[model samples]
Target chain A: MVVNGAAIEFKKVRKTYGNFVALESFSMNVAAGEFMTLLGPSGSGKTTALNSLAGFTDITSGDILIDGVSIARVPTEKRNIGMVFQNYSLFPHRNVLGNVAFPLEMRGVGRAEIRKRSLKALEIVRLGGLAERMPHELSGGQKQRVAFARAIVFEPRVLLMDEPLGALDLKLREAMQLEIKQYQQQIGCTVIYVTHDQGEALTLSDRLAVMDKGLIRQLGTPQDLYDRPNSRFVAEFIGLNNIIKISGSKHDGAIVDGLGVIRFPSEIQPSQGYLSVRPEHIRRTPTGGHPAIVRQAVFLGDAVRYVVETRNGAELTLAEPRSGENSSLDPGSEIAISFEENRLIHLPE
Target chain B: MKNRPTTLLLLLPAALLVGLLFVLPILGVLSLSVYGDSGFTLGPIRELVGSRVSLVVLERTFWQALTVSVICVVLGYPAAFFMSGLSTKLRAYLVYLILLPFWISILVRTYTWIIILGREGIINRTLAAFGFSPVQILYTDLAVRIAMVQILLPIVVLTCLASMLDIDKGLVKTARSLGATPTQAFVKVFLPLSLSGAATGGIICFILCLGFYVTPALLGGRRSILISNLIDIQVHQSLNWGFAAALATALLIITLACLALFRLLTRGRTEFSSLGVGR
Candidate 1:
């Protein structure tokens, strides 16, 4: 079943358990065929949001619309959404073929059709020959593929994955992340994935929703989130950085602050906002910017990261290429460090 | 091989106990059935096949045991399923109620059935108070069947329950999510999964029923006499030890056969993990 261009809309959805609000008036729009990951830590309501879409959970209030149709009362079976769990909840009693065929069997598909469809699904996962084997006989990666195959066997409108690759090792997780993303793109199914890992979200999702404390903190493309981070949380979370909270003002087209006045962009509005600078963005300058004492310089294979304590006592991290590095300043040596103004994101008030 | 001594030490006591209490008696009975009185004789073996009285008792005993086992399974399956549906705390208490009779002596349990089914018992008295005639209950074949089923019901229910509880709850939820109705999910998943346990329990009940003596003797009349009763009659009243041993041997052989058949029927099911024990 093809999902038309209708977006998934959550209209003032709220979920509560007694006095604890799991999701407070959560609302978002997921465009058709878009891959979005709800990235958050535990108990951040990312999983709750995914569960609400899968119909495994009922919201305490409000309606969820899929393809412009209200599905608040629709049961999970009729929701036409595939779900892959974190632990890969495959039926232990059934073989791989039987597990993949479960969806077809539930829909009362005929015997020949069930076999044909299950084989096709297993073939897609490259597990066609292993269809006779039970789940316990397979490795973590193989079991996860079987889970994906099962989720996609019936061609649902959307796919919901609750950290499907969370159980795999680093190498396998990376491979499966690419594989799952390929399947989603190939089938053009809307994917609502939930994971706390920023790397996974950045690698797989077309658009990412950074969630914290039961709310969507930011929803944008990975480049938008990484390049133009709108909050200290998004900046510090999406990448490694030195976040300096300093009072500053716009004067003569430059941001004048506690460290020193540096040339910022002309159109940049200087206000009481946190400035986030990436470690790689900072460069060693000659006698111009903030004067800093080099505290530590650790070589990390391809690059060297420096920890500097500015004259104002604020610490800044700078990364440079390991080869032909100009800075020979030791721990006690003092130098000047400057950063680009465009990389600094203004935090919300 | 290094830990053989420790293993042997741990198993030696059990081995000796079974050897003395179980294997030794079976060997003795087999020898007595073959070697018989005066000398090794085939008279008892011949008599076991030729005697009309032995044949009739054997037939009645087999049918009664089979009937009682079937009744136990038919009633126990739904009871156990109902129990599994209850909350954990309530199920524990209900299980205790089923097992209360297990703690009592078999003789006491058998006699309690007698009182309940007696003409002057509460049931018949209630019927009489309603101006109805008292139904004959005690010392009948039906009385024997009821007593056997009651005594063996707990084993069936507990066995079935163990199997049912072993099923993963997620499978049911997954089934429901895959568009299966509640009845379909249970029939296709839970029922098949629990059948192995029910079969094991039923076999055990049948085997135990085949060897019943005290309950049937206390509750049933002449028509309800089973193979064990015939063995008892030959050994005590008829003074025929060889014939009695043969009858015992037949019962033992039939029980083993039933167990083997049960195992064969359920071999392909992964849930029947303990079928090796039946062999």
Candidate 2:
């Protein structure tokens, strides 16, 4: 299918409610057909960004452009944007067919055409057999599917989802995450999805923007964010990582306070910054590594997680996969943990 | 099932009050309609059917009530919609304003209408000052209707407002996002959801208008006399207790029938069905 998706750009968009800044100088460019997720906790302005793009709330300054044309003055109806709310927002009085056909009806499409397209959209969402069922009769997952069908039925260029799967259970949420990605790919529409769920964002987004305090802290692919997070917030927010403080740095090595000098790869600049290492990247050895006392060892079914305190008093978490040779260690056992110099990411101060 | 007796015991006081004060009096009136001095007779029914004045008064009462109710709904619905959109603090103040006249005695309100709509009332004086004729508005159907609408307006507005407020605001936003203009969103989504409330308010106003006594008696002319005024004439001037009891029974039956019809129409309404947020 040839998807006529439009590229969207936010140019220094700032929004404020009185003195409370919901978005401050926010700017991002989403390529056509790219699924970009704005992931953040509540009060981080991700929803505000989505709402502003959808024309629900006007920005205090700057502009939003779709396909290189400014739509700052356009109203929500004329924006030609599809939106699925977290609560589903299906019309209760309308059955599945009527709800999906509403946008086409509003556009003054013929009754026959509306029915055809509505059923087709329902089929896209895998809810084709439920056209006669009212919104109240449907389960939570069905309601959200109907909402998704209604949003895409009109062939909107940009699909904005505001935590659409937040109400579903974990298993259903995971299932819908893959479904949403597949649907976005099939439609070829630029999708701006907002959610606080890190796993969902990573799973569904082609590129994800991590937002904090009305600012985009980091924007990149999921692997880039995971392997090389730019800041302490992104490193901690994405996955389990141990951030070791570096007391000093030289051209070839960094001096950790508790541990001795640690060598870095030549490409990595030895600066006065923290070193971040993933829990799974740390290796447990018998000797010839940094000595640490195991503080806690948790027996997860697939992996054993160890919280070890180094001789310098800094705490580190290491995850060891369950294997035949590597046995689970107790809390008071002395262990030597080695870090892969290449895997160690240098974060600026 | 085990708590049924306790439930019945708790409801006993209300049931006894209704049986004594309401049901017994209505039953007495119904019995009085059939019984004569000697024995049971259909004389009151025959008289009610035969009297041209009573027929004319009954017809007038129905039409006037219907018209007054339509006026109240048309005027009250928009007022209620406007109030629903206000901030909570402002809406509370507006609610107090709408209910201010309700707190006053109906007699006092009717008297105030007479003062405002009389020949030398505020409206005519203002018209005369603007170089217009001083229209005779008092003791007319128009006078009665004006007074009735003003008195019954607050109830209609409040009911409509209550229903409008119950609608989830997300539905409107969703409609708008689905390419509906503001007006379209309201007509297609908000208006349909709020119609049940408006219907309830209109039915109440219509029922209240059917039983109106003081407003019509005080503000209407001889030609504009409603069924209640005719019932009064039967009891006092004609000294016909049977005919008066029959009229009372008819009014009671009509009000109950209207309530039943309203119930039937609104039964199983899914006005709030779409409001399930699933959270």
Top candidate by TM-score: 2
**Alpha-carbon runs more than 4 Å astray in model 2:** A250-252, A257-260, A266-271, A324-327, B1-3, B263-279
Segments in model 1 whose C-alpha atoms lie over 4 Å from true places: A1-6, A246-273, A286-288, A291-300, A306-317, A324-336, B1-4, B82-87, B270-279
Candidate topping DockQ: 2
List, residue by residue over A1-349, the lDDT tens digit for candidate 2. Answer: 2368899999999999999999999999999999999999899999999999998998999999999999989999999999999999988777788899889888998877788888899999899898878888999999999999999999998999999999999999998888989999999999999999898988988899999999999999999999989988889889899987787876668876577678876565565778889999999888799899999999998999999999988799999889775668878999898998789887775
Assess the local accuracy of residue B69 in candidate 1 as a C-alpha lDDT between 0 and 100. Answer: 85
> Which CAPRI category fits model 2?
acceptable
Label model 1 with its docking quality class.
acceptable
Q: How many backbone overlaps does candidate 2 show?
A: 1
| Interface quality of candidate 1 as DockQ | 0.26
- Residue range B1-279, candidate 1, lDDT tens digits: 757888779989999999999999999998788895577888778988998888888788888888988899999999999998899999999999999987899999889987898989988999999999999989999999998998999999999999989888767766666666778778766787788889888888988988899987889988778888888888899998888988888778877887788878777675332112111
How many angstroms is residue A102 displaced in model 1 relative to the true structure, after the best TM-score fit? 1.8
Candidate 2: clashing pairs of residues: A258-A312
